[model samples]
Target: MRTLTVFALMAVVLGGSGRAAEVVVPADMSCRTEGFGYADTNRHDSSKLSVRASSNGNKSWIKFDQLGDYDLSKLRAATLTVFLHEGKSGSQQCDVSAVNDDVTENIKWVDHPNQENPAEEIYALTWNNAPGNLTSDMGLLDAAKTTYIDTITFTDGVEGQGFEVEVLDILLADTDGIVQFVLHNSPNLLNFATHDNPTEAKQPYLTLRFAPEGADHPVPEDGAEVDTTLAQLAWTNPEPNTPGEPIYCDVYLGADPNRLLMDKVEVGPDVSGVAINTDNFPNFGLLANKVTYYWVVDCYDTDKGLIKGEFWSFYTNDNLPPEVDAGADQVVWLGMGEDPNQVTTTLSGVTSDDGLPGPYTVLWTQEVNDAPAVVIVNADQDVATVTFSERGVYEFTLTADDGDKQTSDTVQVIVGDSPCDASHMSTGEPYHPADANQDCIVDLADFVLLLAEDWLACTDTLTQCGMLLPM
Candidate 1:
């Protein structure tokens, strides 16, 4: 149905001459299709990128720099992918180019070999851009109908907001050939220190130096106390704190922080203090119980970039245990067991947790020898003396409530004596001192009391057991 063709030209777009200018083309602007192009999936295999394009088309330009915002030195590499379908071109013919700020040998270019027939291709902007630099990888594929992935790394040039890339010099035979280009933000591991050929190019395209005038980008630590992991750690507070400013707070975590991360946790504009579990609250949770952890801090200006403070590394924590200064508490007691009378006892302590000792209620109850004892205390009293009158034993206990949890304690007391004294009176004979009724003497040696015959038939009614006083 659709057709495809290889492109003709490729260009590197560069920005103006600032520490932030951009370049559209690379070292040598040229296309090489002999043994280069995207991988099996129509994108780059080695570089970190992937792209897609329209089908069956040609005679167009691929720009690497459109609204160039960065310099060339910041860039690491570039690439282009080509897709081939039904087409008219019997072979491939195209050029890829790159340019640096160097005024001398500023531009680099390459072309693809002619083919008896047409096929899909993938391309890259790599070492080949330089005269003596390796040409193993360069432009390899057509953008139309092909997914092209390009990884471009500039010396000091990179993307921020409102940045653009340009690609041109395209020639495709596919009537429907389309070009899709994408940029990757992956790092160039092996080329972190790669620099442009100062002698070859009079005007270098870009230039960006690392921090500390010599050190590389600072490493981020997880244990560090921060307001947030966001690229920009800005603080905002609509209402002020003790100082009166709307947002006055500090981020505290570890000891001196510069050598490990940055700042003293005393950030500004808004971050000075925070409650528990608040988001970006200094970007880190405070370790409980003085559990030391890492921490850092930084500042930002509307005009000046991030003012990264010296990275400090240490172990320090600021956690306190639960406050035990419970306010008011109370207790009331309810008597238990066969006692014909019921009584309630109560006592009140300082307010459980109101920060002020006051009228408080204490509620508690427990089981003693099969009897349930109940108690309740109100805010009117400060102390209660527990007392019991029954023959049973008793235990005095107290309970109170905290904001999230409750607490209690206990004290023991002894009550009533043996209800089992009858067991010691058992005698050997059923007739003698066992007067059965225990009158301190034996009387019914088999004859004693009498009962109505109507009720005496059961168990052959023993004399002493059946005697009933005349009612």
Candidate 2:
């Protein structure tokens, strides 16, 4: 028959304690002997094996091949199973011992070396009946011969009952990879299915449980470049041989690869993915336009503990928009035949683009309003000129663009009534047709101004009086 020993590596400890793994080894060789030194008589198929202890000491020996690769020092827990087929008598106490002799499948019952002085007693248990006498050592065997690890008690003679024994420490101390065990009941006769049984499913086997392995399959693909500031991180859970165990993941993120600045998210064991954005972390703040970020996912189980993953990184895209800052508002007064250059307001502001190369494009646009304003823009330049035709308020906007993105800012202009209007003075003044000086008196001072500037040919009323009105 073929020998089977399966080794599976589980969790890997990143920065903390080491991880654990599991191994399964099935019995490769087994034989049973009758009382009075009888050799192999029953050539049973691979369906069942038997053991008994009466006047002459009925015993069975089982051994596994090639198991030395497992590091006994790293072992946490282990179990050995013996599948019971049937029993002849009532409750029975069984003695389990480790075989120190070199044995193989070819050996017969009479050829077994340990038949005279059986190997060291490692474990003992009761089997085949309810509330069996577990305290009894049958007086036929001595206790001080070897160390005993643990014991098991059987409640019934039911078929297919697995009598399990813990042998973690015993296996660790064993130098040779060969696993040979001897089973004999001192009080009653017990029968069990062995590796020779035709029903292979009932064969004896051993299982070792340990910590989990490292996480895998990270999103964003390690060192990929992303366009958005918000990123979703994900990874696969470490699979376990013992099913139904809950697994939790802790996500770490930061601009620095070594030190994670983002708040750690305690995700429930049910979820494998998590999202991070500017809203979630205010102090660490939003992800800047063209910055690189590092992240990792640490996986854990309540029983197995923590296993951290390797560090990964991704960069953000750099085609960001420019920022615009329109200069402050301005106010102006009206005058007759006024040259726009004399009262023109400089419409200017600052702009910046953190994206790529060189100077960005700048534009100034005049917004249409109810106010009579003659707006002119030097669209090519960062600063421009704007003039008002009449007394009213005007609004202008400045926009900056960096090919991929654009932004704008607004500024207001207030144009008040001409300051030379004597008729509209706040003070209660009597208006005169020749009030050129607007002194509320309309006297000879106004007349002298009009006469010196050609009063006779002046057709316009305000111009004839030497009074200038806003153009």
Task: Go through the candidates in order and give the C-alpha RMSD of each one to the true structure.
Answer: 29.3, 35.7
Specify the poorest-scoring 10-residue window by lDDT in model 1: 188-197
lDDT tens readout by residue for model 1, 240-269? 223453332344334334334422344456
Measured by TM-score, how close is model 1 to the native structure? 0.19
Q: How accurate is candidate 1 locally (lDDT)?
A: 0.29
TM-score of each: 0.19, 0.36
Off by over 4 Å in 2: 1-20, 37-46, 87-90, 100-147, 211-471
On residues 202-254, what C-alpha lDDT tens digit does candidate 2 reach at each position?
A: 67777665533556666887787776555677777776434888778777778
Q: Which ten residues in a row are the worst by lDDT in model 2?
A: 124-133
Model 1 ranges off by over 4 Å: 1-361, 367-371, 374-389, 417-471
Error of 2 at 366 (Å): 99
